[model samples]
Target chain A: MAADRVDPIHQFHINTIVPIHVGGYDLSFTNFSLFMVIAVVLSGGLLYWATAGRRVVPSRSQSVAEMTYEFSASMLKDSAGNEGMRFFPFIFTLFVFVLMANLIGMFPYFPTVTSQLIVTVALALVVFFMVMIAGFVRHGFGFFKLFVPSGIPVALLPLVVAIEIISFFTRPVSHSVRLFANMLAGHITVKVFAGFIFSLGSLGALGVAGAILPLIMVVGLTALEILIAFLQAYVFAMLACIYINDAIHPGH
Target chain B: MFVTSAYAQTAAPSAIEAHEGVAAGGGHEAFPPFNPEYFPSQLLWLAITFIAFYYFVKKVLLPRIGDTIENRRRTIAGNLEEAARMKEDADAAVAAYEQELADARARAHEIATKARDEARAKAENDRKKVEASLDGKLAESEKRIASVKASAMKDVGSIAEDTASMIVERLLGSVASKSDIAAAVKAARE
Candidate 1:
């Protein structure tokens, strides 16, 4: 146990396992990179293995894989209609990556890649660019129409458009921060309470009895963190779909 | 292992000095993810992994699953359509069979009636011919009887004449003329 230091932020540290210097830049493969790779591989391997059989009546694992597909697909369809199916693969990839990363972080010794701002920002930027490109490609110059609301008084149009544009640009930032903050906070809270159990035990014979409360808190926090992991992943994917809807139907 | 790492970081005087030195130089040591040093690497790996996974899902897995679902739907729809067509064909066949059976029954009845009528007409014609032949025979017999009766009456008349002549001969004891005898007989008969 890292109960002595009791610094929850230490878990987010990126230690380079293999340092690589490229053109005077430190591009090392750290613990963060390893988990990111694990997330990708696990998600890809699961889908491939489940769909390899392709039985009409799905097997247990196949249903799991199909359920994931249907979940992301329906989420996109519901937010953006039939046209949203074009981005199903991208949104699904984003979902599984974040989900697997969060889930693996719940275990000991595994770091949460989604907890890192850089990683979440990277994923959000992908959705951001996809929305922009899709918007421009489909609607051309009319993509700028996304900022303009219909039935607004002409006098207030400028202010409303400015607010809409500001909000639009902030999409990626808020999208990334939501997932990153949730996972980071939940893990830190659990770690802090876990440290409490050990710190109380070390005080004295009488302090051992006091450790029971933090111990129960740690147990409860673990369950809540697990739920947060799943919820954040779902929320991240759902918001991405909603943002993409703006691109597909710019007027809306 | 985690306890040892924590102890090593905190207990080692050199590690503390290094941390202070790095912290004094810049705030980069405080946040590793925000540090410019690791962003390129994280971004690089993320791109590679995400693109690979995206293609795997888009090109490979999705098509296979879609194919299975589509095939199942097509099979079910085709089966239902074929069953309906078969039902319709069966219904038509049943109707045709019933029609043929009724026609055959009607033809059989017509043939039976025609045969019975022919037999009755032939019997009627035979009876009429036999009646005609019987009538001719009866008429011929009746004519023969009439002739015989007439001849018997003539014989009876001759017998009476002879009886009358004998009576006259025995009573008068004289021979009479044939014409006179005949005339006396006619007067007595009258």
Candidate 2:
């Protein structure tokens, strides 16, 4: 019996496919890079294929492409108002990329790009910088008035401003971590349960019997993970829109 | 349920421990997404891919979709407008047809009324003409009848005179004068 041969954390290990060292940088092509490229190819290729025909009555691929476009357009319109539509291209790319990454991750042996903290942080930072730039460019120094609300009592002003400022700064942390932690935790839990099945199977007949519960759990968790995969993508995009909305309409 | 052998159970734990040691961050281990070594490459690739994706979608896919959607929308709107215009035209045509029918009906009724009035007047004139001719004929017949009655009366007078004269002559053995007989007949008639 080799019951303890299963390792759940092993799935997260990063391996360099092409080890390249430039100066002090480790710019090697990696599994993470591969999946990001795959996501890009899949998303971009599908979009290209979908709109290649440009039929008045859309094909299925065109319908999918149109729905994706409309989904981002409407999300921006609803969250950030009409003015936010100027950022449509950026938002659309962000949404489609995240969505593709999440969906791709659901497949076996495919890694999730958004699961990487650096990638998510980078995305969140893009939104954060955009918000600051847009706010400052539009409102100048008055953009700081977003921390202050209307009709507050004099005594409670300090407390409210402090809270608002802290919450405002926490946006990127929450934004990135929400996606990263959700993907990491869900995958890890699924892996741990899956590991249990293999480990218990090594205990012969009795162990196989005990493995049934973990097997069922693993199956249920996989389904849940798929749901989370879609949901986290949506949440990430939605937050990006909301944050962008703050820049468009400062002080409200 | 079949139980596993005790020896297998004991062996399983050792194997599991060896697996954990091998898995637990040895030189072979790359500590997942947090691995500082993978960050630069991932970010670099992400930037390149995302920027390309943004431009590709913005430049190519979105415009085509927009054209299709806008074209479909315009076509639907045009169709609706054309249908409405056609409906209005049809309504006008039907109204004109109905108006023409109403005018024809009114003209037909007027013609019928004029024809009826003319026929009634002709009939009245014919009746009056017939009444006048009948009156004239009746008057001529009455005049003729009066002449005939006068002639019969004169003849009757003459006959009565003759009969009286004969009767007087036979009885008296003398013939009476004609004038006297005529006078006696007339007096007796009176």
Top candidate when judged by TM-score against the true structure: 2
Q: Report, to 2 decimal places, the DockQ of model 1.
A: 0.25
Model 2: colliding residue pairs: A4-B16
Residue A47 lDDT, candidate 2, scale 0-100: 87
CAPRI-style quality class for the chain A–B interface of candidate 2: acceptable
Candidate 2 wrongly placed segments (more than 4 Å): A1-5, B1-30, B125-133, B167-176, B180-190
Taking every candidate in turn, the Cα RMSD to the unseen true structure, in Å, is 6.8, 7.9
What residue runs in model 1 are displaced by over 4 Å at the alpha carbon?
A: A1-5, A203-209, B1-29, B83-190
lDDT of 1 by residue, A1-252 (tens): 453247666777777677665776556677788888888788788888987787877899888988887888899999999999988878887888889999999997789998888889988998999899999999998999999988899999999999999999999999999998898788778888877877888999878999999999988999999999999999999999999999999996
| TM-score on B-chain, cand. 1 | 0.62
* Cα deviation of B18, candidate 2, in Å: 19
- Report how far off residue A224 is in candidate 2 (Å): 2.2
Please give each candidate's TM-score. 0.71, 0.86
Per-model DockQ: 0.25, 0.35
